[model samples]
Target: MWAELIQEVRVAQTGVQILFGFLLTVVFQPKYGRLADTDQAIYIVTVVMGACATGALVGPVSLHRLVSGHRVKPRAVRLASRMTLVGLALLLATMTSSLLLILRVATHDGYVPYLVTAVVAWYVLCWYALPLWARRRNRGGSGD
Candidate 1:
């Protein structure tokens, strides 16, 4: 379970790191100064969330390194799993906010909120709903 969790964290960490890096650069872009106050606020929130997601996703590695030989593998794994889940939730928020900012800046359409809402629903379905459904369905199945 520890190995599997680390593998999963690696994938999420890569994605969040890339996103946080990109968010860092966005502030240096000239167009950033032209953004409205509300848009800038959203950008700030998105960047902060991306940073947090990156930290959470990367936490398992640090946890493992610090706790190696501490005889706390089970406890460490449980904590790391919780961090990963929080990271994923933060990632979802970052992506949603980033999408909202992009759509608002690109189209300036009233439908942007609706579109963002739909995309959030899709993310929730893909990220949370299906896995939970499968877990519940297999609760009484074979040990495999």
Candidate 2:
């Protein structure tokens, strides 16, 4: 379980780190100053979500370090797994908002929110719904 937790953390950690790094750079871009107030607010919220995702994805390492010799591998793994889920959820929100802001700025279309909604639905289905369905199936299968 510890090994699995470490492996999962590594994947999410890298993704969030890269995303957060890019989010940090957006503020330095010249066009950033030209964005509307609402867009700037969205950017700020998205950056915060990115930061939270980064922390949650990286939490298992700190957790392990703090509880290494306590003989609590199972509990630690469970907590870390929960944190990873939370991180992924935050990442989804961050990506959705980021996409919304970018598309709004680039296209100035009235359909940006609808497009973002569709994308959000896709993410929920792909990331959460399918996995949850699998879990239910696996857990409720016949004892045979």
Candidate 3:
């Protein structure tokens, strides 16, 4: 479980770091000055979310380093797994809003909201629902 959790965190950590890096550069772009205040606010929130996701996803690495000799590997692994899951959730929100803001800016069409919502729903189903259902079904069939 620990190895699996670490591997998952590594994948999420790379994605969050890349997203956060891109968000950090937005303020310096020339076009940033022309955005409306509301857009700017959304950008800020999105960046914050990215940062938090990065922290949560990377937290397991720090946890392992700090507790390498504490004889709490199982507990630490479980906690780290929870953190990674939370990070993924935060990341989903950030990416969804970021896409919404970008598409709203680029297209300015009435369908942007619907498109964004659809994408968000897709993310939810792919990232969470399928795995949860499979877990429940597998567990229930174990005859415990």
Candidate 4:
């Protein structure tokens, strides 16, 4: 369980780290100042969300390191899993906000909100709904 959790965390951690890095750089770009006040606010929120997600995704590793040899692997794995879920949720928010800011700046169309909503719904379905459905469907099946 620990190994599997670590593997999953690695995938999420890499993504969040890259996203947070990019978000960090955006503030220094010249165009960042040209954004509207609302877009600037959105960018700020998105950057904060990215930072939080990166922290949550990296938490499992720190948890494991600190708890090593404490005979608490199972408990650590559960906590880490919870952190990963939280991280994923934050990542979704970050992505949505990033898209909203980009679309608003690029097109200024009335459909941007609807388009972002659709994309977010798709992400929720892919990232949460499908896995939840699978878990429920397989709950009574063979353990293997």
The prediction achieving the highest TM-score against the true structure is 1
CA lDDT of each candidate?
Answer: 0.96, 0.90, 0.90, 0.94
Q: Is candidate 1 or candidate 3 better by TM-score?
A: 1
Instruction: Write one digit per residue (lDDT tens) for candidate 1, span 76-133.
Output: 9999999999999999999999999999999987999999999999999999999999
Q: TM-scores for all candidates? A: 0.97, 0.91, 0.94, 0.96
TM-score between candidate 3 and the true structure? 0.94
How many residue pairs in model 1 have overlapping backbones? 0
lDDT of 4 by residue, 15-115 (tens): 88988898899899999999899999999999999989999999999999999999999899999999999999999999999999989989988999999
lDDT by residue (6-110, candidate 2, tens digit) is: 897798788889988999999999999999999999999999999999999889899999999999988998998899889889889888988998898899878
Clashing pairs in 1: none
Worst 10 residues of 3 by lDDT: 135-144
Error of 2 at 60 (Å): 0.8
Residue pairs with clashing backbones, model 2: none
Q: Can you write out model 3's per-residue Cα lDDT over 68-131, one digit (the tens) per residue? A: 9999998998899899989999999889878987987798789999999999999999999998
| Model 3 per-residue lDDT at 120 | 94
Residue-level error in angstroms, candidate 2, position 43: 0.6
lDDT of model number 3: 0.90
RMSD of 2: 2.2
**Residue 41, candidate 1: C-alpha displacement in angstroms:** 0.3
Two-way TM-score contest, 3 vs 4, winner: 4
